[model samples]
Target chain A: EAGVAQSPRYKIIEKRQSVAFWCNPISGHATLYWYQQILGQGPKLLIQFQNNGVVDDSQLPKDRFSAERLKGVDSTLKIQPAKLEDSAVYLCASELSGANVLTFGAGSRLTVL
Target chain B: AQSVAQPEDQVNVAEGNPLTVKCTYSVSGNPYLFWYVQYPNRGLQFLLKYITGDNLVKGSYGFEAEFNKSQTSFHLKKPSALVSDSALYFCAVRAAPGGRRALTFGSGTRLQVQP
Candidate 1:
């Protein structure tokens, strides 16, 4: 089976610019998650979706960040007016369900100047 | 709130030697623990997890972790270290009683296995 796929392995943008990353999860997976991993730190959950419905997004920065999993197969995470602090790797992962193991994508590395 | 801590910033071990990376967690009620490994330029990979059974759980890539409820720790261990095992290791935990399934992760420990 194919693994989770992400686009634009790396990206660079100036502060205040807008950027977006895309993710295509593994086939048949029912749950998808987006996480932000800063350098030297673990990945932090940004949002989670269970088949097109959001399961949790309490940690997401509503003012600057937003994500959507339309139709439950693919997802996109966007950050508007990016800041230096937003520089980090964005990872996408998928699982069959709540109890299943998550498989991750290589991640999209975003560098905000 | 649930959280995890990796006390060691980095660990160095020669090939064939034993390796240990310390981890501790804080959460309400029972805890679900997990260990993940990340290679350079790659995403995190699931190494193993402890749900509700034995305190000792064996995981992928010849790794294991011991859950000590009394100490609130779940340290990852390997009997023999391989140079290929060098990578960033993260420990995570989730609250058991709550219906929430999100994982709270530690900062991460870099393991360097020398040849």
Candidate 2:
């Protein structure tokens, strides 16, 4: 089985600029997640989707960060007016519904100047 | 709310020596504990998890973790450390069987194994 796929392995942008990262989850997986990992810290859940409907987005900064998993397959995370604090690695993971383990993508590293 | 703690920022051990990475967690309900390893510029790889059954769970890459309910801890252990095992280890927890099921991860502990 193929692992989760992410695009633009790296990205750099000035503060207040906009950026978007894409993710393709493993085949047949029904649950998808987006996490933000800051330097020297662990990954923090940004949003979660069960199929195409959102299950959680409590931690996502709705004012700047938004994510959508359309058609219940691929996902896109966008950060508009990116802030310095937004510079971090964005990871996408997927797992079968009711499964305990999650398979992750290599991740997209973003640098906000 | 669910949370995890990795008291040590880093752990150093010589190759072929026993190694341990401590992790403690708190959750509102029964806990689902997990350990993940992350290499440079890569995503986190599942190491092991404690869902139920045995208190000790074995996982990929010769790693294991003991789930202590009373202590609220799940510590990763390897009998003999390998240089290749050097990486960032993260402990994560989530409440069992309810809610959103999103994991809350610790800050992470970097393990350095020297030959």
Candidate 3:
């Protein structure tokens, strides 16, 4: 089976700029997640979508970040006015509804100058 | 809320020697524990998970994790380490069956298998 797919393997922008990353989850997976992994730290959940409806976004920095999974199969995460601290790898993961295991994508690396 | 801890920042072992990476978790309900490996510049790859049934769960690349409920630990183990095993390992947990389902991960432990 194809694993989750992410676009723009790398991105670089200045602080206060805007950037967006795309993700395509595995076929038929009903649950998708976005996570930010800072250097020397574990991945932290940014948002979660269950078939287009948000299941969680409490951890997301709403002031500067926004995400949407329009059709429930693919997602996009945008960070406007990117902060220097926003430089990290953006990871996309997916799972079968009610399943325990999750498959992750290669991730999009962002660097804010 | 659920939380995970990887007490070691890194673990070093010689090739062909046994290796172990420690992990502990806290959750309000029955916990689902998982281990994942991340190569440089890559996303996390699932190693194994402990949902139920067995306390010892075997996973990819000859890795296994023992779930000790009393200790609230899930430690990854391998009988023989290989140079290729050197990478970052993360421990994650989420409450089983209820509440929020997203996993909470630990800071991660880097494993260095010397050849």
Q: lDDT of each model, Cα atoms only?
A: 0.92, 0.94, 0.94
Q: Which candidate order results from sorting by DockQ in descending order? A: 2, 3, 1
lDDT of 1 by residue, B1-115 (tens): 8899899999999999999999999998899899999999999999999988899999998999999999999999999999999999999998874334778889999999999
Ranking by lDDT: 3, 2, 1
- TM-score for predicted model 2 compared with the true structure: 0.98
Listed per candidate, the RMSD to the true structure in angstroms reads 1.3, 1.0, 1.0
DockQ for every model, please: 0.65, 0.71, 0.71
Clashes of 2: 0
Off by over 4 Å in 3: B98-100
Location of the lowest summed lDDT over 10 successive residues in candidate 1 chain A: A94-103
- Please report the TM-score between candidate 1 and the true structure: 0.96
Best model per DockQ = 2
Candidate 1 lDDT over residue span A20-112, tens digit each: 999999998888989999999999999989889999999999999999987889899999989999999999999876564788999999999
Worst 10 residues of 3 chain A by lDDT: A94-103
For each model in turn, which proportion of the native inter-chain contacts is also found? 0.66, 0.73, 0.77
